[model samples]
Target: MIFCIKLPGGLIKWCRVINFKESASGENPGNLKTPSCFLPSSKEPVRFNLYTDFIPLQKIVTNPNLSL
Candidate 1:
């Protein structure tokens, strides 16, 4: 998934969130602080909304068990 954090001065930066692995590549995971930088291909898709100016959008409920 993609996590986008909006800065105080209207600056938006996005990061790819993923599960933490003890050994991503048998290398010291501690050395690699940013795991997203070494993600494999075919990752989840992320969209950059053109009209959203740090405004929250209404959640769409598709599942019958979901609620607002």
Candidate 2:
């Protein structure tokens, strides 16, 4: 799965790929945060849209041979 985050006022000057770490243990599982993908402005409002080919989570997680 890929996320398409939209930024207001052309704030997305650059983006950095990051990997999020899963939570250790709690009601919230498999939650993680990526290092901030810096924007050009701090006051801009941003929106995110996630996209995927509708591949099953099992296929996405299990297939090490697949290339993004």
Candidate 3:
């Protein structure tokens, strides 16, 4: 899975999911693992649960008035 995060400076960070960890408790049941940066960079991937540090991005409908 691809995760995109918008920084405070209006920069978007794109990362690829590396692994997943399962949990029995907590608001987020599972965690997603992703690299801190893309390849060619030397940062290790980190694990974060959904709804905590990040959430799934949903499709935006810019034209609600426009007919499909």
What TM-score would each prediction reach against the true structure? 0.25, 0.21, 0.31
Stretches of candidate 3 exceeding 4 Å from the true structure: 20-47, 50-68
User: lDDT, candidate 1, residue 40?
Assistant: 34
Top model by lDDT, which number? 3
The CA root-mean-square deviation of candidate 3, after full C-alpha superposition on the true structure, stands at 9.5
Best by TM-score: 3
Error of 1 at 63 (Å): 18
**Between the candidate structures 2 and 3, which one is better when assessed by TM-score?**
3
Off by over 4 Å in 2: 1-5, 10-13, 18-34, 44-56, 59-68
Candidate 1 residue-wise lDDT, 1-68, digit = tens: 45665545576756554432433464665634433422233254443332232233443334445443
Cα TM-score of candidate 2? 0.21
lDDT of 2 at 11: 42
Quote model 1's TM-score.
0.25
lDDT of each: 0.42, 0.40, 0.43
Query: Cα miss at 4, model 2 (Å)?
Result: 6.2
Candidate 1 achieves a global lDDT of 0.42
Model 1 misplaced regions, further than 4 Å: 20-68
